[model samples]
Target: MKKLYILFLFACTFGFAQNPGDIVITEIMNDPVSVSDTFGEYFEIYNQTASPIDIVGWTLKDDGTDTYVIVSGGESGTGTTIVPAGGYLVLGRSDDTMVNGGASVDYSYGDSGHTLGNGADEIVLLNTSMVEIARVNYDGGVTFPDTPGASISLDPSSLNENDNDNGANWCLSTTPYGDGDLGTPGAANNACAPTCQTTLGASDTVCDSSNPGATDDTYSVTLDFSGAATGETFVVSTTPSGFTIGGDDPTSTASGTITVSGVTEGTDITITVSNTGDGGLCDLTRDITSPVCIPINSVDLELIGIIDFTVLSGGSDGKAIHLRATADIADLSIYGIGVANNGGGTDGQEYTFPAIAVSNGDHILLARSLTAMEAFLTTPGYNLFDVYLEDSSEPSQNGDDAIELFKNGEVVETFGDIDCRPSSDGTTVTCPNYQFYEDAWAYKDNGTWTYGAAQCTDHDTGNVPSTWTTFDTPCVYPFVAALSTQEFSEGELSIFPNPVSNGNLTIKSKFDGEMKVKIYDIMGRQVLTAEMKTESLDVSSLRPGLYLLNVSLNNLSSTRKLIIE
Candidate 1:
């Protein structure tokens, strides 16, 4: 009788330990593409219970011999690692804060014995007495596929522990975090389940009716009925309206294609399909957000010019130059001058125009290496011109080096100061232009190069963006023009109350003939363009900073510094 009573007590105690769904493994980033696994590997856990749980003495172990004990209340073996209700906890390496793709680590397993498997592994959670609570046996590209530099997140809608073991319940994380890594660590899992899958097809263009030279936009989309029942129907709609759909709605029988028309130029739009089937089992719906645009081609082509340059070492990425086409051009060649860094330097590197065409108002990125540039920007969507320049001919430009763009063997645009400073070896002999450091970009404003903010890229043409302004920050070198040119001083131009505090700046100039007034930020980005019928200009919308005001009349132009407080 005493033996039976002891057995009942043991059963009761085991039942009170932990429930099956109290905690769950939400995300796993076993492999990182940018950095090594030692510094970037991590896993996240979510607490589903309504009250805080003291998880002291809890053991997290992999299929291998590695195990990490949760330390709480400053105790090694017995203490409480209190996890708030409905919160997340990240278990990672000790120095994960330094390299773990910017994930917020709640606890570190240390670096000694904890390493997750990249191919196949098992993660098990246990209570104080070593009783198993949850276990996930995942295999790369199978149970939980591996996506380098991205985490494999479990579907939140299907958060059951039993369903989590299935490979279908897992997906590659699309949530961007940390220095461009993808995952939501120490937070709720991203929604992964899809009622239907939609894909955008190639775009087609026709001549615009409203505009004389613009093109009419048309797009194709394919919708697959994967999670819905047969004979179900869906209604297609688009954001910004005026999108006409052609063809039948999606059904479980096969994938359906729809032609969308009446899209506006230079604007982005989204397409949504909602289930309209009567008495359907599921209200399945899906959306293809932000379709790629088919840019209009143009007859005249002009180099909007280079906006920024990255020259310093140990920067997030390597050197890059931004270019823009005012209008579309076919088979255009862009060659660089003065890129060679030899004892007797010559223009050696040339990027021949590819057979493919560039669209009107499109931005082009030229870099030393496409792979290095993508890794630095953390964006892989940039279309790079594939021309590998020799090391001696690459744009290894300093502040004083000149980079000129050539078209048809003619200099269309030029950047940098040719004779301001000379190169040096940094130690015994230093030059003004050779002072290269990390995170500094040369900004062109009002036909002059100057020091501004550190930015990855600027896609806008003909103007410097506000993102390129970083005033009074250290680690920046100002621009020094060459001897032959005197810009912004050709005309007698002045502004009263130099620092305009009331959002109104008055411009005083000698010439008068319907002067075109343009305002640019310190980075040379034109923010406001208008005709100055009067001397006073309203700058209420502009933020507090330094700006350049360009006043152009008949045959004369002048630039003046404008400060807004």
Candidate 2:
């Protein structure tokens, strides 16, 4: 039955009525008007039939001196060669040859001297005796909205090459394969096989018996990592336009990157290979066998927020030393004291070797999470007012939502839910639910708990706090500690007395400097400017119920809400 199928295919090739063989020119890139160099121009051919056919003696030529002929002797001009049905054949210039391993011709075809533009150009394919088999009179190349470099293409599939002489465009292949979208190689169809990759520690072992008796060689590639450690990977690849393995459709890679991980010591990996297509030296399959796996370990720890400070109040009057406690994935038990003031009057709490003491002029705050570590520090007052997660850990997670501030192993304050930012879950579910409470000061002063405006609240209704928890004390009220939230980066340049009836706003900065101010109306139109040396700005001149005031210093800008009384 196989021989009969072969005979039937051969007969169709000779008949050449309408490409009788199983092969089809799925793609063609023949256009007379296209301005392309050698690599830029080429033809593509695809086999649509179910059987294989030898495309030997296929000759390609342009009206100019640029001529490309397949050197036939075998499969790749090597032996009895055949392009299996449904396969692809990419034919391009010498520059394009690297794309498909095909022969490259001199670039003399589409030059300005030949006037091969805005009109038809003559291209042909011939057999051994110079007998015209296939040809094309490509119309002016197709034009894209933005692309100037484009070519023509042929559609559908055909079995045999056309046996004609003049004026009949016989050049078959013309699919645009360079677009990175691996479609049918030589056919106009943009359908290509999805990439196939091996498991992390697996091999790409494909058998050749699938396409038995076919000249298209099949190789088995084994990606070996035997006798190596763990976590080893390497790139195994092949070149050629239509090297399709494991399937009939044209594919970008028969097999992709192979990696081996968690291998027991002294076990080598073996990856197999297969190359089932027609081209020059298509079966040069190899492997990155017995590769050594390097072991590298790293931890991404982040400072969540400041825990609590071991305040030694006696050493420095009005100043307390703070020891920051951190929790992370790597080391959870031990902690460190980040920044402190080394002023006169030795601190009782030594942090360097035994412990470090906090001195005057030194303020401690929580640092950001390096990985999963949460840092906690005391505001200026040592009152344990506000507990801020690291800027990185603004968003908290489960397990350590509220860090316990212990004084010498005694739980003095239990910071309830923290508010980093807002969430969709509703104010109660959020850590920073301060803004939701109409009377946030009342909630915090009630001796209950201070909620961050970011605490989740359901806005579906009038945005309200759904969950409430009373804390023994506020985390860190930098505002009350004289640190001033306004001095903090986020709270800098805030205007108090929001309902100012006189438009007299007081601007305060952590750092003292001349402040440049600009007031703008709701429409973003600037109406006033006060480059004053004082911290207070009088905006009573501007008529406004609501306005935006921009405070700038050293090119850094901060905005504040301005209300005119």
Candidate 3:
């Protein structure tokens, strides 16, 4: 009774069919782990015709040395050998439910005569005439899935002789049969949509770095792709070596982006992706040039000058700051400016720069009013301004105020000590280190600030250094940018032996007749004063520390930070 598959031969009466769609191999469980190969190994076939497909005497064989004859079954008592339209047929090595992993075996191919190969084998079905009706040559999971305990099933929606030929048309079955093994034997198969790499290429511009505020110029190459199989892992590599390509290996999804870090700029890259396990069918390759990295410069500038007056009527404008770039600033938006009114401390950053790039030594005039600045620059001696931007904000300083330069919301540089207020009792000359100015402008020379001659409305004597020969009554501000930055640093004035290790320090300048020298300590107290008859001055009398050295020749003066050891 257990070996009763011959019942299929007694009750079945359908003869041979000739339609190509009559029968198609739908699934295979050659590598089943639930049971031994002698009992659990099996393959499934689906009937495509509207009528039953009976393999009464059809020969089931392989290309090499495996063959089985469909005869009077040995273990099926149900006599279900005839596959009804849209039904399945499961043929295996054993017929007993206990030994065959619970699969309802329709007919038993003798375990001695025929068995499916676990790797690289062909399945051939022949009709009564010995003519090949259908065949599937699976190459050992190299192309098709090879997961253990799971049978490879054809896509049921397109179940046909031609569609079953390609390995891509099959998927590992997940639906478990009665044996608790994964397969859809003796029934319709689950769907299978094979995913393979379709395309790959760079999609966006190369950025300076993956991080913000970083100017280290980290190079990267990012590529986007589609069609990598879900369960399969794809490998990405670059030809020119030295890169951490494909972060996380893109196993997260079927399609997305993969980035290559640690890449060097200006290297020619050949990006290759082995989508398929063997790279046999679906692979991606692209050729691209790693561009030169563009760095985003942080706030790096020197506060070169500032102005606080305008001759134009209704003098609510003409307030500005003069800046010189220390590097190639890629973005200015991170830099801001603020004015500390009166003796008050910082008022926070009030004016942010727009998106602009400034090169080293380029002078900038961020002003309160463009119209007022242009009208004022028309004065006879105005030049020096390179780049101009107008905005009514923090830099709108009155005559008596301090200016702070901000980078990333923090102050990096400050001009005119914010907490220091000028003291004038009408009799004594104004405070020596006073930052106040009235109806005038101030310019930076040798990294220190000095004022242009103008009336000090608050104080009678004013007692401030002067350089401008022309000043309009209410607001006559003149600027003389006679030398470029290079000439100013290298040609115009050069001071050497500044530490005054011995007694004498050398000063190189265009003049040699006579020069006035005034040295002040950090507290703004005039410490040493002298008149240099030649290029050498004796400073041994002063103690060792930081000091401000103001040198004036024929009214043109320059103040520099001096250090004594």
lDDT string, candidate 2, 175-281, tens digits: 43444322234334432222222222345544333332233334443343222111222223343212332321112433334332333222334323323232211
lDDT of 3 by residue, 152-213 (tens): 99987769999898787889988887668898778778888546535564555375463333
How does each model score on lDDT? 0.57, 0.37, 0.69
The better candidate by lDDT, 1 or 2, is 1
After superposition of all CA atoms, the RMSD between model 3 and the true structure is 18.6
Question: What TM-scores do the predictions have?
Answer: 0.33, 0.22, 0.40
Instruction: Give candidate 1 regions above 4 Å deviation.
Output: 1-17, 73-80, 193-565
Which lDDT value does model 2 have at 59? 56
Q: Whole-model lDDT, candidate 3?
A: 0.69
lDDT of each residue in 467-509, candidate 1, tens digit only = 3321212322222111112223534666678788998878777
TM-score of 2: 0.22
Prediction 1 global C-alpha lDDT: 0.57
